[model samples]
Target: MDLLPRKGITDDEIGGQVARIIELATLEEKIAMMSGHGFFEQIRESGGRLSAHPYRAGGGCERLTVPALYFTDGPRGVARGNSTCFPCTMARGAAFDVDLERRIGEVMGIEARAQGCNFSGAVCVNLLRHPAWGRAQETYGEDPWHLGEMGAALATGIQAHNVVATVKHFALNSIENARFKIDVRIDPRTLREVYLPHFKRILDAGCASVMSAYNKMNGEYCGQNRELLTDILRGEWGFDGFVHSDWVLGVYRAYAAAAGLDVENPEPIHFGAELLAAVKSGAIEPQVIDTACRRILTTLYRFASAEDPLDNYSIDLVASPAHRAIAHEAALKSAVMLKNHGALPFDKIEVRLVAVAGRLAIIANTGDNGSSRVWPPYVVTALDGLKDYLGDAKVVFAGDEGDSDAAAETAKAADAAVVVVGYTARDEGEFIPGDMSGDVRVEVPQKSIGGDRDNLGLSPDQIALIKTIAAANPRTVVIVIAGSPVLMNEWIDDVPAVMQTFYAGMEGGRALAKLLFGEVSPSGKLPFTVPASASDLPFFDRDAESIEYGPYHGYTLLEKSGIRPAFAFGYGQSYARFGYRALKARRSRAGIVVSVSVINLGEVAADEIVQIYVGFPGRMVDRPKKLLRGFKRVSLIPGETATLRFEVPLDSLRWYDASAKSWRLEPGTHTIYAGSSSRDDDLLRREITL
Candidate 1:
């Protein structure tokens, strides 16, 4: 009775068993397990729709009794039927609450498992190189440190339940439109310091897998780039997990196996028979195939054996009330109050007649329906939330169908006008074919479905509507519903108050109602810098097949060019005021500890994002004005004070030296700036030598 080979064992006992199982596995079984078998066929059978039903993507060996890995897309929520849709990753990043993100990860893991998915492809840490990057909403932010910390929290949370977490778009795969064809030529320093740090952080957290980017890095496809897949990821960083290709058109050549890609996902377009032929023709070694299979099998066994397999879970856990509450909490925390001129916290009795303008107010506007789509039981619209909250108070709605003048005339009678505006799935998301192709080689049905935005401004009609409403009603609050930053130069001055509620999850509307009525304070900060003008940011060409990536973007570029941002990164305001005082920095064994007392000065309770930036001494090479090293979100009640201590890791402060191809922390008098945002003048600084 050698039961070790049949029954599922614990993760600790999988090391020796993995080799034994691999030895028992034949060449066909190993190759079959290396890539996703019949993956695209399953999607095609399902009409290219994602559902709760399990679609085995990889790692099932009948001979070895290895369970298949059921994977799904994520970051917001599980990408399946009737799943709880949390706020977008950008929204979570704005919250700056790592603990909350971990909670989200835990719930995501539960739901993903409930949906019969054991592998979650959710940890999207691709840096937001530009705000216009269509899939900007999927990632955390532009800063490497912020993305790393946030992604690490998410990866850690997902793996807690024994679900495999996949950190994606391995190298620089920011651009959306030309992702399949673009060559991002970046300097070694920029690639190491900015582009790749977040992925490394996720790997350090022991993410189960890495999804190679579709784009080419320095003229080589990421899936087939040995320097990226083998040298950096596997060799240098010691990522032992299997590396999979992006869905559909991830790899173009079968020899990608030689490049260190362990799995070809969704389908075996480039793998399967082509890969078999290569191996038989001496183009690839059988040992390489064995290595790939072993990696995949080992990782799968580690996760599958750690807990009961996901297929046994009930579907009721997908969008449970508790899970929806997390969505509400995310929405509450993700809202960034851009401007408030005594117009927010709508008094129930005082503000009787409220006009909720724009079509977005009534729509169930979650986000893109590409890969991260979550079909909640019901979506709470802004109108629904307001109506639910303001029971006796009259909340009027002015649809976009009517004439602008008529809408404005109606708004004049209201005590205050709240206009909901901004983009949806039509404007941004994961770039896919208009036809939703099973194969990417086929031409896109139409123009870019999900690609980099051509512009960063609101629609002219929306601008006109806001201006009209502002002129009619002295009290007007503009709420922007977008995934990323939007330039507000056109009509920012017209509106009295402005809020950026990124595609907040299923309960976003309810959360919006709470923030508007002062039930909860607006606590979310800007994850990316809002440029005063789009021209101030880096050059972005979404359709360009090849481009050069610079070391600086977002706030770094704006600061370097001496251009002021419309709203700096990590900037957000609450209903109440917070004062930062008693700032001190001292070196500790862990690293430099920067402690500051944050006191809520206003009568209302609120939350504050304490951001710590290290101003590296200008010397050997050009550096960012200041880099975000650490941040924490602290909640405070009225008149309450808390001492926030942020540990400044010396390793994070190190700059990548191109000559040595290693990170070097220069010893100098570094200025530690503590503030609510990245604005230089707003920060309280103390000089310290490291």
Candidate 2:
């Protein structure tokens, strides 16, 4: 019997089938569909790894021909063995190319299906409230508008292959150290305006699943928060898909079923026998269990019954050459050039001996070693890529800062030098030993993986290395590998050129080589603001049990406080020069349409990200100075000009009124700024009345 997906099935018919299956299933069988199975055996087989393959979490019944939900984790790629590792989500966020993000999502979906996964927890849209958050690499960026656009694109691409795309961490899951116990205190207005908008945007884009966070919001665990899961998600937003817990300790009690949680992931510690007993003892109603099962079956059947876009699910498609090319493209587009004093785009003929310094240059430093880690077939390092790119020109390498003198001498003898430095998994990532709340039986062995970063700047040794290399060779380029923004005030002035390559994936080295050799121009922009000092940002305590989330962060906070950042939110330099002119804005039927003409004045072809920001110069209520409304990526050759237009929705300009408990559009004249970055000097402004 063929079990492939069928073509052209209606939603009503799928719902009827789900209802029939729920009615036919026994009480025990129905209970079995609420959580993961084979918890202990999976751990044993993988030797305690987070996710070795696609684990069947819940939902399947042979008696009713119901299919199980096979789950895989990622925002980079399929979190399984030998998968194509693309740039991290934060790195891709820097690209600001929705089309590129969608293409990457399609590749991820194809790979997930080939690995036998029906559900993908790959669309992580959690807001980056603070860069110190360990898992910052998993999210898109700080701006709600930007996050929503990038995440929605990925979700749309993934669902095209008939896989259920999950938008994750429900709400306010930024802090990573005390994630399981922290009670995030956020007001309704701040919650709606800042954090929850992105999640709502992804759901509106037709995403099929959600993963509840481990943290608490207003003193209630997100896995069991009725206000968040039921009232808002179901009643207000009308989301019909299922929601599962994060991982082993995601759900603490069986009564979470009534609280709106549908499935417990990677195990059934709380939702298995305890839930059965709760139902039998009248502690939990049968209706709750039935509702959860119905939702699960409906989503599973809907995806399983749809026709897959691909003809075959070959294992060879896991890390195919085509997918790797996308990864390489993402790496190339995501690299942000922070500074350059005419010391970049090294000429291969002029530079014969190139010296590569630092320890990270030789290692395959893709990303954190946590759950999102992808085991690509191979990873190219900087040394290997530079050596390959410059065949005749000799490339020399130097190890860590322990031998700073020797490294500096090597740089002094070479024509140019490239020093790679930055944080590793030990410095920051997803905290592994999560709080084993309630009565979980599995013993989670301690792994040296992740925690919130205490210091935002690089180590003393790295700072010294940068200064030393710069002193020895006037032409030295510094490459930083990190998940989030690193404070570089200490040694930034000493280096002639610097680039932030945030955990570039398997093809990162090749992209880096291309960028350095002028094969491609650097076009990626900074997704988050880089502050001159940590105090310029919001107050953060990674280990705090309780914290208050405010209405401002990133560039908004900087502008509101009248402080200057070392680099603006959307700031990045390209080898090719770009000039903006002819700024125009007009009211359309949808809302407002803003257009600007951009011309490439340099000698090479390149891409430029056109940013549109909306500012309320005069307003009744307190608000950020300006918020990012829309962005578009355009490509142009030397001396060529392109006119780009962005449609700003009327709804995007509304502000949440705490007293009315609804969104309000303040009537006033608004200013629209268009430019290459968020800096004031880079933008051209126009005024419009609503």
Candidate 3:
């Protein structure tokens, strides 16, 4: 990249300014710039919870004209004001549309700036190690490659507006319930290949900042882990941007500066007076403090001197009509129809009377209002969506919280029934409470909601209601409104169709209505595998104080053990059928180019996600039977055929050799599986020799 002077400061000028500012500023002013000023005071004024507006989390140097870094929490939307809430990151991952996700990132960045925030903590790329791990919705999915690609797209898009994007919960912070105290143990190879790869990808995309995770990796907290912050992220990866601790309690020691933590966010209990005392006592070097402050100021000026996104980002930009439409598009593409027996696309079934039953049907349920919450202007429920879509048709909605019999009777009477069931804030999401024994004691702002789920299965009552409804109505469709995969064994066989409409978003209801009525085809595919049983996944105990993280999880683990999943990763259904043909794979200077012709067989326009998984010949070493190397989403009309090409880099197929401590491409014939899902039967295989 060329380093010529643009409208902003030049590289030399930035360096000179940082040094000059450091010398001119008082020690107190430098430390003050490293933390929030009115953060806790504002929260206290709002009575314990942050108000629906941007909160000053860090950065303020009035002497140098450096604006206080106004930060907000999220992976959904700008978690402040009436921002347009798109689907959760998990939902966007399911969409598997990088371009769409980028566009979504653009809107989020635009809205964040409109809300007067220059920094965004919205790119959450943590791997979904377990479905029951409450904050699973905040991240992309279970696989590192998929998470990396999607996260990179988002980071790129957000930074396009010069809104310094921050990729958060830095390394191995998957579990929610015990995040504050959990110490995750993992081997170097597994950590590099599976867990840390995604973060590296985001850094490669030139993300402006990083927030250390709350949990400990190995024996040390992430905020103060010298190996992670200094040795790997800065020294090895060459991430020039600043690294900040997660808000409040994210930093455990005053010597965090020595470990490369550039800033302490929120009120900064650890890095304030304690840090000043440490410096005076010669326990910490003043050079370490200068380096930390310099990094923050350098990253700050990088965006501050750049051009503003647009003129006067008025309040109207937040959740405006155009943004809402983007939200609708996100929800439309993210809703994955997992199973269908010709029971979907309500218009095709000749239904005049419809029945909608569920506690979540008519509620303004978007997601947990913890750190990632977006208080939209309004939310449309599933019942509202169905009623609005059904217009003049008779629609019956029953929410007998405990009367399954009455709901069953209503289902029996309707022409077709849509049963909405799944977890809400009361069920799961970023667990903040240390006490999970029912008696709650909240000390400060919590990152979690109801905490990690008790189990993956649906509640007993919801299961019974689903079974009863399915028995009474042969044309029943189950709509799951969860953040992650929900095991559906108890009643999956009873229902003819199932759709995962993740905590869709503010405009989710409208999107759900559009999808069910054949106005739009369901194009989302499973980003993570839904296992036959929870036992098949890596052992996950959210409450465990210390946990060993294995190398494999999600589809990789299930495939390695030869255990079948309920629905394999990348599996989804559409009203329009798709056919794959003419599979070709060849090596190019760029990488392996795989081309395939996709045809829409049905009489409706739809999108098909073509996934390519590379399988190494021989089982001499531990490896996933196949790893997702590349994928593409193509749209086609009725009887339309389009050729889609995917570039799979040779590096993507390399293995992390623990002994060598580097990536190595084992010499073997690599088998490429090209088709819709991870299931072997669903793909067309072609072998390529290295």
Candidate 4:
């Protein structure tokens, strides 16, 4: 790399003005400026030495004679090393624990910097728009507010380790249907109110780049949409980071530049010397080119270290004791119990011949590919977890045809069967979208943002297996594994107990085992409702580009349509019986102060998730009948009383006054309901005024 110093500009000037780099770089070189280099080559070992090429994998693309920045995939876990393969973000969200997510991000950041990676694109804080979306496994669940807080926390933690976090797909990349062709038509209010808040939160948390998606938005490609990229992000929000395009989203370099995308990755896709030439020759404004380059250079300058430490060091990643502990804690907390018909907490000390079914019961994880992928050293499967706890009893492992016991062996010889069933890592949900085969070098895909799921039910094989297994074994417990809610219409009645452990992360296995034995009482609450079927919801497709949303798709709409969910949001079951009593609320100048006492009446210690839901009972505006105001997670011993208090601001209680076009407070009475879940309220009818 060679450059002639500007006559009057000092080195300090170069540092201050990244805009100057555009003046000196050639047209072709400028186009080359906005892409990235690959890090991981291959995941699984095949034959000879693990080879590294393009994308740090097999091989692709001839060199352009210009050096580029290097990047990799991750968030939930590191991709390189004999690393512990943790569950993706979707799994982390099911934990219903924000602090756990931050810790997960911290470790991931530590590993990313250690691996010599520059930027971790698609930090994946986007809200899940459609449950059937295949990429739903890669994103946080339905609520934008939750996603914003959790995603922002993770982004903030990752940046602390000196690696740049790139918040991804800018806007509405949720649906997988016709992603490349369909245009997502969304209302400005919904876009600003519901969808885009998480993005803003991520950027404010110090993310350095915002990756553009493959799809079109409002008729133009999101990658080069000026209104979205420039007007909203650069102009309105004042986002200062680079705008990188998804790989292979080609042929719109000038339009994209004018629109405001800074770096077109894996280059020549909408960016190259031709676009640069167009900029200088009056075809495209030089300011667009200058602004784009400056943004990228500004971001790149923050991480312009020439040294590569991970070039040599290889730690025993999966073997590290600390990593395992982290995984264990995450797994334990992530296990969310949806149904407990007094069927759990079985006589663990006396039970004999415990049989377990399903491959996931024996395997480490199911969703361990793509950006959220991780490399775990040792996995404690469901069978191993049960066996480890019940050393005196015979714990048999039966790999069911699906989630059920069609084989008849696990049940034929056992006293009780615990069926652990799930979708595979290679199944519908998520992937890095490249050749996982050792053949072609696979880098992150710029085009493959999402996909559609296969179907919503357990396969015919799994259904039949569960029915047969339940008939044989009277005391059977079913654990359902999924990234999003699916209908359990077939065997819901037969399975005495059921738990939804949605892709619990690396340590999930231990957590699952702990919950089963009442060692750790169930605490996690549902973030999204479990629909009876996909047809019941308004937007339940892979690609929901052109859907018109109102109160139907979201909680407000579902409540109006009288469509009952199989399980409501924030639904969970606990081993110990708990009671919420004496709920009181006082409204002051600041807002409302609510207090409640949570009593554990059962015989064992337990973790309780106390949720405060607020309802504007009368004279209010458009709101979700009630919304989650605050929640507390605590551990309680038998007969222990935990008193909890929370202060709510007036702004939090204010409603969006559409006619006035501003947030306004109305003189109205609101009801404060204290509950374990949205479906069931333990303490009711505490009033407050706003």
Candidate 5:
């Protein structure tokens, strides 16, 4: 019998079907449905490679006609081999284009489905509490509102293909090295206001599943934390989807199922037979198993029964030319130009020779070599792209960082010099042991694998290299490739032009070539603030056993401390100049509608991101100086003006009232600022009272 739901089947009908299937399932079958086959077994079968295809994790029972969830990891692209790798999540966040993010999500879902996967752990929305977090690239920005919108768009697009999208690392999962043992101490108000709004936003957007983090909140692991898994996620937010553990060590107790964890992924040492024993001995109720099975089966059947967007899923669709083009588009839009002194958009005809320096320029550095890594068929390096673009022009390249004098000599000879530098996978990524065993213990040394960054600034050698290259060549452009903010105070003033291209995917090199040669303009913005000093931000201890999380970080922290960032959040420049005027605000039925007229004053056509920041002036309660409430990306030609309006929802303006255990909207005069960046000088303000 086909378990796929027929067309037009209501959710209630699916629920009923799921209930019947659970009722028919035996105790053994129910327990079997709650865990994965085995991560090691799958790896062994796949010639010792992790996730050779999609990993099968529970719920396939022929007797019940319930389909199993084949899981694939992502946020960049499919984790499987030869899949298209788009720019990292941080890069996409810089673009601030929801439409582009949604398109990338659609490609991810299609590629995943074509590779025989139904569940995608691709929607990683963890807040970037600190740039030092090793896995910062997997998330969007530091703000909860921006994270929510971008994650929602991605989840929506993925689900459009009938593939289950899982928003992951549930709460307070920023740290990397000590994630397994770190206890994040956060007050109720701070938790609700700062870290969780983004997760709630995605849940409300109809995401089908959630992956609990490896870290602990308050005093308990997130997988088994009752307050997190049940009280907040399900009890308060009304999330109906199933929850899975992060990986092998994500769950510690067999009774995690009772705490609302539906599945233990990639081999459940704790939840498989151990959970069955707990149920039989009355340590845990059998009803918990039934509930988990019902949720998983319902979601699985619903997607399985839905009609696919394409007629057939072919392997050729994995990295199709069309999808690659979308990746290219993302790379183009995500490049953020931090500084330019009339040295950009290199004249292809006038410039006879170009110098490319640094090791990153020659290597295909996509992103962290962790779970989010996508093995595209080929990658275009900065060297390759320049050679391709400057067909007749001599493109001299050097990757030796130790020999800066030689590199500088090469730079001195060239008309323009491009120095590519930043952290690699060995420097930062998901912290995991290089070798694996059956017991989930680290058998081999892990000194060179993923871990949190110890320093926020570039290596001393990189700084010296930049200084040398800049001193030698008057026209120097430094392209920084990193997952998060890099302290550029060391050498930022010395360079004429700089751009942050955070792990731009396989097409990154080509996109870089286009932007450098005037084929496309840089339109991306800084998602996180670049503090002048590391001490100006929040206190971060990668090895801390216990840490307190406050409501402030990123631009909020910088604003609160009255510290000026080297580059403010939402700051970026374009070849075309944009003028903002006629700023206006009015009360709407929802909350408030803010409109601003923006015109491209420069001769070239370009895109501009109009940001809306809401400030609580003279408020009784403490709040950030301003919060990013709404934003829209607009494109304009020379002398063309467009009026853009953003609807600020009432819910967005509400502040969590810890006293009443509810959200309260303050009724008073609130200032609305419209600008390109978060800096006061970049914005024009208007006050509106509610």
Candidate 6:
């Protein structure tokens, strides 16, 4: 029998087949899809490659259907062998350009298909619940709207390949320590407003699958929670794709299948036996089993396999040099310029002293741990990039304590110092299982991840080294390397300049080589705010009183608490200056459209992201200080003027009014802002009197 059915198969045919399958299933067969087969250990390293065995050979098998489904992990980067390892999501998120994300996703999707694995089972858009959460670096950052926008772009990019792109863990799977069993207590208002948006966006983007969470929400297991699986996921968003359990999310086969899940992933326990068992026991209706089977089969068919109805999987364009160029470009744009005391644009460096600090100054400079910790043969570090670009300018190198006395000695000898500092692979990404195989090996998490980070600030050693270097050298530029936002309390005030280069991917070193020599202008923006101190907001760890236990922190609540961040979202600086003026906003029948004149006021060329935010003031429902409904990234040369337009569907301003349980739009004056950053005090707005 054909396992993969074409789309829109006759309703009668679908109904009939489901009925026949239901009638044929034994209780054991019905129970098969409930749970899966798993590897004996977390991971197995063989012949210089990693393989995840979801099933054991003796695992129960089912007779019906085609070959069993096999899948691998990833979103920020592909995990299948034979693909180029991209940078982590934290680094990608910093690019602040949605187009860049789409391009990067395309590259990832192409590479995954080329590597011979079906697409990533999940995009693991891990939301940032707490800064200290080990997996927080795997997320886009701490903002729901921003994560949603970027995640949506990527989801659409990858799933477009006919391979599934799974938007993961459903809700708050951020805290890794107590993830599996902890009851994540949260208020429904925040749940609908923030935590749910990214998942919703990914689903809306046509992702074919979703992974249930390992943790519980409001006194229930995530996989078993009907409210999330049925109510919000299916009820509210109208998601028609199949839902799979995260590794080990299922404890019972019949219960999970009856609970609205389609398949148990990784290891398909009992093979197809569980579904057959459910059928015989009468615990699950036959049609339900058939429907689940049909969904699974249909999904499997979408793959570029023998069963696939879509175009054959052949060469993947995403892995081509053209695509890596996209990643190279994004890795560059995601960079944020924190402090620029004219040590920027490095437009004039004819034979100046250049001293590089930290391991990231050259190759293998990226975060060393996690799924994205690529085993590529080559890498580009900032140090090597600088030396290569500076030509005859002798550049000094020193391993400054991550702040040691040795740092001071080196600083005293340079014409200028570019201190490269950031966490290494040890402190970030998916947890490494540790090599028990005799040879020294770094273990990485299989499926679920939780390794990295002991504190929120840089090591005292690095801070001390920074202070010494800053005091000794008048011109010190600290270049931060890492994937996520780090706390900058002790030494930020003393640095004359600072630049952040997230784990730059393949062409990373070469990109930095270009940026340093005035080859490319700096245009990356911050997706998340930098807190004045780690304590400026709620604890990065989910303390009993923090938002993780209830309502989470965002601009909306931050304002209520009267706490200000060191930097606001969408914030970035350019080599050239730009001016915003003459806001022309007109409320139309369709929605609200705003236009503004952005003029490049400096000598250098630059691209500016025109961000539009809508605020529902005095909102009865808890709302963000503003919601990013739309934005446009445009480029211009000096003295060039570009008029950018952004339109917000009236629905963008609507909220889930708890009282009515429907989307709400208050008939009040709506304020809109068109500016460079979320907290732009410089430009245009108009009140839409509805």
Best by lDDT: 5
Q: What TM-score number comes out for model 6?
A: 0.88
Q: Candidate 4: which stretches are off by over 4 Å?
A: 1-28, 37-69, 250-253, 302-319, 391-393, 402-406, 409-412, 431-450, 541-545, 551-554, 582-595, 616-621, 645-671, 680-687
Tell me how candidate 1 scores on lDDT.
0.85
Q: Quick one: how many clashes does candidate 3 have?
A: 3
lDDT string, candidate 5, 1-690, tens digits: 555457668778988888787878898888888888757766656665556868887687777677789999998998986899999999999999999988999999999998999899899989998999999999998999999999999999999998999999988999998888899999999999899999999999999899999899999999999999999998999998899998778898987999999998878688877898999999999889998998888888888878888998789999999999999999999999999998998997777899999989989899888789889999999989989888735798854488999999989999999999998997889887656343564333334478899988888888888999999998899999999999998899999999999999999999999999888899999999988988887889989999999989999998998889999999999999999999999998998988999999998889999999999854768989999998899999999999998899988888888889898888898999999999999999999998
- Residue 666 lDDT, candidate 1, scale 0-100: 79
The segments of candidate 3 whose C-alpha lies over 4 angstroms from its true place after superposition are 1-7, 434-448, 618-620
Error of 1 at 625 (Å): 1.2
- lDDT winner between candidates 4 and 5: 5
Question: What lDDT does the true structure give each of the candidates?
Answer: 0.85, 0.89, 0.84, 0.65, 0.89, 0.65
Clashing pairs in 1: none
Choose 2 or 3, whichever is better by lDDT.
Answer: 2
Task: State how far residue 444 of model 3 sits from its true place (Å).
Answer: 8.4
lDDT string for model 3 (157-215, tens) is: 88777788999888898888788899999888888888998899888988889999999
Models 1 onward score TM values of: 0.96, 0.97, 0.95, 0.85, 0.98, 0.88
Candidate 4: minimum summed lDDT over ten consecutive residues — where?
51-60
How well does model 4 score by local distance difference test?
0.65
Give per-residue CA lDDT, model 2, range 1-690, as digits (tens).
222224667888777777877788888889889987775667667867756857887898766666798888898899877899999999999999999999988988898888888788899988988889999999988999999999999999988888889999998999998998999999988999899988899999999888999999999999999989999899878999999998866778888899999999877788878899999999999999999998888888788888877898788998999999999999999999999999899998888888999989999988777878888999989898888888635888955678877899989999999999998888888888743324555455644569899999999998888899889999999999999899999999998999999989999988999999899999999999998999998989999999999999999999989999999989999989999999999988778999999999999999999999999744578889889999999999999999998899999889988898788888888999999899999999999988
lDDT of 3 at 59: 62
Stretches > 4 Å off in candidate 5: 1-8, 435-448
In candidate 1, residue 63 scores what lDDT? 54
Q: State which candidate, 3 or 6, has the greater lDDT.
A: 3
Estimate, for each residue in 1-690, the C-alpha lDDT of model 1 and write its tens digit.
121333367555676777776778877777778777655455556665654456567777775667778888887888877788898999999999999898899888888887778888889989998888899999988999999999989998888888899998898988898888899999888899889988998899888899999999988999999999999998889989999988777888988999999988877777788898899899899999888977887887777666453445687887888888888998999899999988888898888888888978889878876777777888888888888888635888865524667778888999988899898888888887655344533332334456678879988888889999899998989999888899999999988899999998889888888999898999999999998887788888988988999989988989899998999999988899988898899988767989988889998988899999988887867789899998999889999999988888778888888899888877888999998899987799999988
